[model samples]
Target chain A: MEKKRLYWRICCVAAIILSIITFTPLVIPQGVSKPELGGVPYSLWTSFVITVLLVILTYIGTRVHPGMQNEEEDL
Target chain B: MIFWVWVFGLIYAGLLVFASLRSYKKNRSSEEFMMAGSNIGLTLGVLTFAAALFSTFTFLGMPDFFRINGVAAWIFLAVSDGAMVFLLLWFGYHIRMKVKGMEFRGVAGLISRCYENRLAGYVFFLSSFLFLIPYVGIQIQGIAIFMDAAFPGSFPAWGWSAGIVLIMLIYSEIGGLKAIIFSDAIQGLLLLGVIWIIGWACLSHFGGIGPMFDKIGTVQEDLLSSPGPQGLLTPQFLFASLIAILMIPVTQPQFTTRIVVMKSMKTMQLMAVSLGAFAILVILPTIFIGMYGADLYSEYGRDEFFANAFLYDQPDAVAALAIIGLIAAGLSTTNAQIFALGSELRGLLRGNENSIMTKTKIGIFVFSVIAFFFSIIVIDQLVLLARVSFAGTGIMGPMIILGILSNRKVSPAIIYLSLTGLIIFLLSLGGWIPDMYFDIRLDLILFITLGIAAVISHLTGTKRQLIRPKTKE
Candidate 1:
């Protein structure tokens, strides 16, 4: 359970980091649309990648979240 | 088109009737009536949450947004939604545990219990009513506007709005929250189907994704990048929107109730993940539709763009399906908000179950009537009004999160602070005060201030002592 908590914490941190990264110029470079992948613009493609990653992180968070056992018992 | 409308409309109405009848039960317990027996499974859960979250706002508002504001609109809603589901997984656990083994009242009721204060509940209810009513109103207006375009000179927009409200009241009053959930599921699927059909049609116009952007780049290169033409969708605006949307599950009673009513915590968590994927699926197609609009109808007004793209441009069957699908989308969301208000009111009322149910139903009726009136008068861009609604209710987020997650007996100062924040937000929205100071948005500043105060309140709070329920005062 403790190890699960640690993994959940890591997942949370990674999610938060990804969210913060999205606002940076590296992702949403103002007035810049080059470095496009297959015709999608820069910000659009990068943010799209980040959005999917966050969902994947959420799926992993569900797997390792520490409170699931207690909650299941309550149910 | 009208022939197809009748065909699809009758089919949709039949499904709605079946769903409500399936949910109705005689002599049902108040718990069963108001809370759906606290047993919603994965499929229904995901669909209801999606339907409620992405309404006419997504259906009509998003394409218009992307058309005008450009690609950053994706970051505005889609990215924010992505992060919101992550927060949902974390917040969901804490809130579910907090309400475990207790009667799951609405968030206003549960937060009041967590804080041991009635005013906290009142404040929460007040913010929800203030914001949600107008949002619901505008959604009704959206449908009314579209209907008027579909059948010009048949009836006034207000007539359509009234009819929509009447149908919502009948089914919801008969079947309660369960009925609302079932309809939401139907609407979710319909919305997904109708949007993709229209989107695919639009994409076919462009030939492919590569040609689509290449074409848009020539028409307007700014549409291909951030802060497009009008210079909105800045980093600051998108980040602020992210916080507001993140607070949605925390502060919105409808969503909070859905979280608690899931069959188990596992389903709720999985629902969160699935909802993220669903958000992506739903919002992606809007980009194609938006790019299509930007390419074809760049100079058209909002109404013209909607009519041509969603109606006149499609085949008779597809256009008719758009009409029914739109009604389903707007109906599902408006009813969810109105029903949630009724639930919030039920939480604040003190009385016998039967009387409370009667009053709750009355309250829902009253709210629908008010929203009907609002639909006639409210006018703005659907997406912008929605953002205001979100940022408005979101002022209560810190208070709610602190109330639920803090095990300590925190002071009631946060409640008053939240009330102050709510007033400040309203004042700014009304333009009685500046929305930005020192180049920072007022809403963002308020979110930060209230969040910090909640942290301090928790730190200074006394540790709680549990007393068995049977021995409680």
Candidate 2:
């Protein structure tokens, strides 16, 4: 239970951090030459990567629950 | 070309009807019909959730958004969707626990019960209805606009709107939520496949991704960076938008009901992650398709650009398939929201269960009509209009969280604050009031104020009521 709460807080903080960096002028400034990564802007790539990264972390957090781990029946 | 398009449409419609009939046979009771017997598996849940969440907006509106706003459009949607998935993890767990302990039928009922007042439910329902009717209409309207352009004077846009709404009502009434989920899974797959196929075609037209973006840089350099040419994806706009979209699972009855009915918490959690991944897969292609538009059709009007890119640019076969896919996209999303309103009405109606079912069915038809009429009047710019709907409904998020997550009977002040916040935000949106308070977006300010009010109300009213998580017996 404590571990779940810890993960929950981490997820929330991660969300805020994501919003802060991507939506604000903290890292990627507005109306400038954005670096390209794989044919897309580096800023956009970072946002997508951060999103996937955090989701994986949250998925790992769900493994703390016994029912989640054992209930593997495919729909 | 038209013959093939009609054939695909008819086949898709036939399959949907067959799936609905299968579900109808199993849904012998009202509860089963409305709630899918409350144990939907992970696959159907994820597909339905994703199909409902991304629709014509992803297909048509998003490409247009990128054509205009540039690459920041990616961050605006993808990052917000990620936050929404994370929220589904956090909010879904607590709300499911809340549902297990209560005899509530919808978020409306649960929230009302938490506040111990019927008005809270009504307020919640009214907020959704006010925003969602237009949102649903935009889905239909988007396709109607395209239909008008594709067939040009064959049927009026309003006729197209009415026709689609009738189709949606027939299937939803036939099998209810289960049927909708079944069809949603089908639509989900078609939408993903068709978009990728078209996206690849568009990318191939420009040689490749790097060359395509390089071409865009030469044509319009501003589009390659932030604030685009239109300056629409501003920092404040994106930040407040993240808040609005993140609240969707909490505030939108369609998604809320979906989370509650999943076979288990594990299913809902997995569905959340899948939805995030699905969002990335689905939205990424729109960027390519939009870049194609920016290169060739930048000066064309919205309707012309959509028709040329979506239809004229493709081979007849793929374009025909895309027509069916667009119909599937628009109808899947429209059905979910309109039917959710029915489910919400069922939750709030005061009557015997049988009579409530009758009334709710009637209510769904009425709402569909309202949506059809709303569709005729809505202008183009599908994604932005849809975002307005998200923002409008999202103002109720704090009140809902307070209701679902608090152990003590929450103070009535929270409800009032939410209502006040919703009204101000709406007025601000309408230009009857200013949009910013102290240079902050009114919606953002409202969220903050509502959060503070909830805290103050909770602190003043309850000294020691612990919000203990409900353990299963």
Candidate 3:
């Protein structure tokens, strides 16, 4: 049950981050000279960067499970 | 036009055959063959997952979408990656635990046993088989299309189809999943290289990204917008697409097998992250290539858009490389699909206790034949067919999730709810009823049906009764 709770918490945090990234353009006004890199919009790059960071954080948090210690035994 | 393209293809096919035979020799038991003795580590697991996700669809169809719609096509990359991460976090651990000490011959068997219902298992097996065959067929057809376009005069479409299928059969028959993964790792790397090169070339030709988009801004401003044309990605559609993407890994028999194949939860988690990164990086270029192609085509007519705009007048070398890359992507995914279907069918026909080698060989033969026939006969629009098939799986997602959450003993009431959801979705798809009874998308109608089913299942204590633990002797 603790593992399940931790999993859900991780999911909720990630989902919140994704939602913010996906919906940011709706909040930001258009006049800002957000430099376009490689034909991709600046807002998109921002969102992608945030997503990458979230992914990294989630990966680290999830890996703390004690079950992971028995990795070598699986082989 | 390019002799080396054929040479490369032929050599690749030969290697696949040799690897397949080697895998067959190494496979001593069903567990060894099906799940790689449950010893796969992060590298191979991540590679296979990325390869499985990036298919002919990404290679051929993505470029077309980019050419037609511009940058919005990149949404798929996020969708695919996000879906993988979500699945890994939400369900991967439980799946690993459920099949930890067991030899799960197929996803259907795993789910059915969990739900304590042979009927559900059989239905899930049949549904996966039916829906997945067309997907495999599309991959086969994609290979044929790429070869036809690349070689032009030398290799006919049928020859290309036959050659790819033959190669797939050789490895799949011999090596099972192991051979498939090994080849897929190589193919995935090659695909990444090819797409990067194409993206670089396009940028170089266009005088960099800013100027390219500046040109596009003059024509279609909506192309640059988030919602995109006609709000094709309305909030509801976006939500549906998200749900569809999340549910896909769970419902897909091929993907679920990956869960069973990994040696440990740590490997699975590592695989999820690595695969997510690989998928994102590889797909980013495809979107750029699409946007580039779209810009080029705006000057030319849209009819000659994807193939002609990008490669029609380019040098033979570049065109041929692009063709080979596309074919590789298609064949890699197609081979995996064939293997998956074969594994599922083998488990159903002879039970999970059968010899893996013999079952795999037979599966190869059966699936290859089905793929060949379906590719030849299915004359409908490929994209439409793919979408319809994906939507069909949506109906099964609820049942699979409920079954898993309930520890596999799903209430009959939940099963009835699942059936009701399936019916509504089918009705919506077939146009038996208009979508807007009072301005609602038909998909929402089905989702509502699913919600009601869940409520009824909850209120009536259906889950409690169905999932009650059995007394031990």
Candidate 4:
């Protein structure tokens, strides 16, 4: 239980860090620069794809549970 | 163009009414009606939290903030999500255990019981009631404005606002929380679909984000930056805002009841993480779309940017979709707020379960009527109304923190301390306090007050008394 709690905390921290990093380029007020994706600023494109990725991750995460529920027992 | 929007709006309204009526029939007892029998599973709980969290504020204001403020608004999601997770893991679970079989009459009741302080609970109740009605009024106003924008001549703002209030009252009065939650899930899904469609259409219109940001790069770079136009928000402000955002779910009576309704700790955890993740998906797109709108329509003023851009120049389909999304957001939030306020009032009246349920119905009716009336009066600046509502609730943060600390036998003096802190914070915002106080932000004031309150509580040795576990009735 302790280990799982630590792992979740680490995951949350990592996610926050990743969010900060992804957020960095935009925060530096150099004016709205084109997002560079391999040579193209993937501004909307990256955001769209990242949104898709986040949605998928959320769906999967919601579905996975350690000892979630037993339908028969509740019934 | 407007005809199609009217059709969609009418259909959505009808569907909401049907759902409410159905849920009302299913509500056999007060427990079933208010808390969904305390058997809400992971899926429903998550959906409820996400739907409740997104509301009209996120639907309309988020994109507007993004357009005016830039990426700084996106940080709110991160902070709010973190807060939700922390609440579920630490505070929510304990609160659930503490109040295990008892129906949370309201946040006031819970806090009063928790701290053994009836006066404190009453104060919380009064504050919540004072703020929530205006808050609901803002939502009703949002719905009216959206209707006006979408359907124009089809329905007057007053008529549309009344219709919305009527529909919300029907479901809320009938099914109570069950009706609200079920409808919220549907609305949540619809809003999500609307978000995707708008995002996709905007992307396609701009030929993609690359070209869009390229335009932004040439026009203004700071639009993509953290603090954006307002040099007002600093790192300290950001931290404070994040903390404030976290406290929202905790302080909100509507949200806490959802916490109470969950089946188990594991379900609560699942719901929290899922709600956070879903929020990022559903809400972030609206912000991006707003950014896109900013780039597309650079001529407009900041406040009118999002509404004007989407309504004026966009393709008919895109305009329709945006309007639909906005309506869904507004309605979802308004319905929940109405129910929440109703529940709070019912608790304050100290009515019996059946009486409380009936009073709750009447409360929803009265609240909706007031909100409908206010919508007409404040139709001009819905966004400003929304902000004022948020600031009103901001006073609750310190009070809530003090309440929680007081639970641990912290001094009642902490309540006064936090109240003083809130006053100073608000005054500072109004420029009543000179800025020379080491540039202390409002958020900083709250933190310092809380810290002092904590120290005083500790020194006074007024830690909370542990209650003996009572047997379930």
Candidate 5:
């Protein structure tokens, strides 16, 4: 149970890091000259990766939850 | 195209009515009507939640945002939405546990009960009303204008708005929450299918994703990066938007109710991930369409741009399907919000179940009428108007967070502070006060300040922790 709780906290902190990077001007400099990866700009690709990371975090959060059977039984 | 549009529209309407009729027999009590049996499974739960999340804003407004704002719009919405799904797991577990074995009236009422103060409910409801009604109005107005643009002379914009609202009211009144969820599922599927289909066409027309962005970058280089030409996606604006969108499940009654009604924590957890996936799939196409607009429709005004990009540029069948998709997008979202407001009122009323249900239905009608009237007044810029609504409702986020996370009796000062913040945000939105303070967005400042204050109060005030999940370290 403690393991699951710690895992949840880590997932949440990772989510916060992703949010900070994506929404702030830190990842992408506030200028016209931007970097690119392949055809997409680095800024756009960075945010997209953050979005995907969030989804993965949710997947992991679900997996690490220890009370899944308990919750279903409660239902 | 007109023939096909009429055919599809009629068929869609028929399905909504059928769903309502199917749910009508079971909706004999307020609980059944309002809660939809509260045993919703994974698939239907996901569909309903996704439908409510992506509305006409995703369809029309997002493309327009992309057209005008550039690639930053993706981060502004899609990234924020992804963050929202993550919050759903932690927040959902806490809120569900908080309200276990109790009948949920609304988030507002639930907060009131938790804080041992009725004013919390009113403050929460007022925030929701001020924000959601305008948000609903924007959805109606966006589709109405697009409908007029798609099928000229078919109906005036107001006429289209009134028609959709009336249809929503009739089915919702008859079938209640179950009908709304069923229709949401249908609408969700249709929205996904049509968006992907159109996205594919746009990509193919431009010769795949790489070549499409390459062309857009050449034509409008500023669009491929942040702060496009208009500088709308500044760091502050995007951060504020992140906070606002993240608060949707926490503060918004429609989503809060959905989370509470899930069959199990497992379903909520899975549904959160599924919603994030749906957000990506649904929003990916709007970027293509918006980039298309930037390429071709640069000189066109809002109405002409949408008409050309969404309708006049498409084949007859696609355009017809686009019309139905827009309507489904608008109706699904508007119904959920207006119904949520009704449920909020039902939660507030101190009466028997039958009487409360009757009054709640009447409240839904009145709210829809107000939204229909506001729809006439709302002009273009669908995404911004919807964002304004989100930021507006978000003023109460701190209060909700404090209520859900802490078990202590809330200080009245916190409630009063939240109310004052809500009024100031409204005034700022209305231009009665300067929208920027110290060169920062008023909403951002307000969100940060209230958030900090809520945290301080929660730490210093009465320390009662009602939700202590099993933790062994």
Candidate 6:
């Protein structure tokens, strides 16, 4: 259970970091849409990837969140 | 098209009536009617949440947003939604645990109990009313305008708005929250189907994604990047938007109620994940439709773009489907918001069960009437108005989160500060005060300041952790 808690914390941190990176110049550099992946604009594609990653992290979160372990007792 | 409209319209109306009748009960408890008996499953939970979150703002507003803004518009909503669901998982668990042994009222009641203050509840309810009613109104107006476009002179816009409010009131009065959820499920599916069909038709205009961007590039090079033509989706705007959207489940009573009423922790957690995927699927197509509009209707007005792209630009059957789908989109959110306000009012009421239910139904009627008036008088960009609504209610996020999550008897200072912040934000919206302070957006500043104050209040407040009541669910 402790191990699952640690993993959930990591997922939380990763999601936060991914969200922070999304607003940075690396992802949303002003007036730049270069390095297109298959012709999708840069900010659009990169942020799209970030969105996918956040959703993936959320799925992982559902499995490892420590509160889920206490449902029989608490919920 | 009119033939198909009658066919689809009758089918939609028949389904709504069926849902209402199925959920109606002669001896229903107030809890059952107001809270759907607190047993929503994963699919229903997800559908209701998605349907409420993505409405006319999405169906019509998004493509229009893209047509005006640029690719960065994706970040403004889709990325924000992605982060929101992740936050939803964590927030949902805490709130669910908080309400496990108690009768879950609306957020207003929950926070009032949490802080031991009626004022907190009133402030929460006030923010919800001030923001959600206008948002609901504009969405109703959106449907009205679209209906007028579809049938040139059959009924005035106000006539359509009145019809919508009547239908909403009838079903909600009959079946209550369960019926709302039932209708939400139908609308959720219909919204997805209609959006994808329209998106596919739009994408086929350019042959594929690459050619689509290629065509847009020739027409408007600025659209391919951040802060497109008009420069609205700047990082600051997008970041502030992310925070506001993230706070939806925390502070918005409609979503907060949805979170608390889920069948189990597992179900709510899974619903968050599913809602994320749903957000992606729903918003992805809006980009295609938006880019299609940007390519073809670049210079058109908002109403013209919607009519041509969603109606005249499609085959008759698809256009008919679009009209029905748009109505479904608008109705679900409208009923959810207006119903939620009534639920908030019920939380604040002090009386017997039957009396409370009676007043609560009256409250719902009054709120719907107010929103109907707003629909007739309110007119603005759907997406921008929606963001304002989100930001407005989101001002209460820190207080509510502290109320729910802090085991300590936190100071009520945050509550009053939240109320003050709400007023300041309102003043800014009224243009009585500048919305920017030293280059930071006022909403962002308010969010950050209240968030910090909540942390301090938690630290300094007295600890009074009570023994956990036995699990009752």
Which candidate tops TM-score? 6
lDDT of 3 by residue, B206-311 (tens): 6777776776676666566455544454445544555556666777777778766876677787777786678677767766666676665655542255466335
In candidate 4, what are the lDDT values of residues B83-105, reduced to their tens digit? 44544544565566567556666
Off by over 4 Å in 3: A1-11, A20-39, A64-75, B153-156, B298-306, B313-315, B350-364, B379-385, B435-438, B444-448, B451-473
The CA-based lDDT of model 3 is what? 0.64
Instruction: Give the residue spans of candidate 2 off by over 4 A.
Output: A1-8, A65-75, B463-473
- What are the per-residue Cα lDDT tens digits for candidate 5 across B105-169? 89988988877899999999999999899889989998888888887897888999999999999
Pairs in steric clash, model 1: none
By the lDDT metric, which is better: model 4 or model 5? 5
Chain A TM-scores, per candidate, are 0.92, 0.56, 0.43, 0.45, 0.80, 0.92
lDDT to native, each model: 0.93, 0.84, 0.64, 0.63, 0.87, 0.94
What's every prediction's RMSD, in angstroms?
1.8, 2.4, 4.2, 4.6, 2.6, 1.1
Q: What tens digits encode model 6's per-residue C-alpha lDDT throughout A1-75?
A: 989989999999999999888889999999998999998999999999999999999999988999887786322
Q: How well is candidate 3 docked (DockQ)?
A: 0.29
TM-score of 6: 0.99
Off by over 4 Å in 4: A1-75, B301-308, B312-318, B379-395, B398-407, B422-437, B455-465, B468-473
Compare the candidates by DockQ and give the number of the best one.
6
lDDT, candidate 6, B7-109, per-residue tens: 9999999999999999999999999999999989999999999999999999999999998998999999989999999999999999988888888879898
Locate the minimum summed-lDDT window of 10 residues in model 5 chain B: B464-473
lDDT of 2 at B55: 89
Clashes found in each candidate (C-alpha, N, C closer than 3 A) = 0, 0, 4, 15, 0, 0
lDDT of 6 at B428: 96
**Candidate 1 TM-score for chain A:** 0.92
Instruction: Report the TM-score of chain B alone for all candidates.
Output: 0.98, 0.97, 0.88, 0.88, 0.97, 0.99
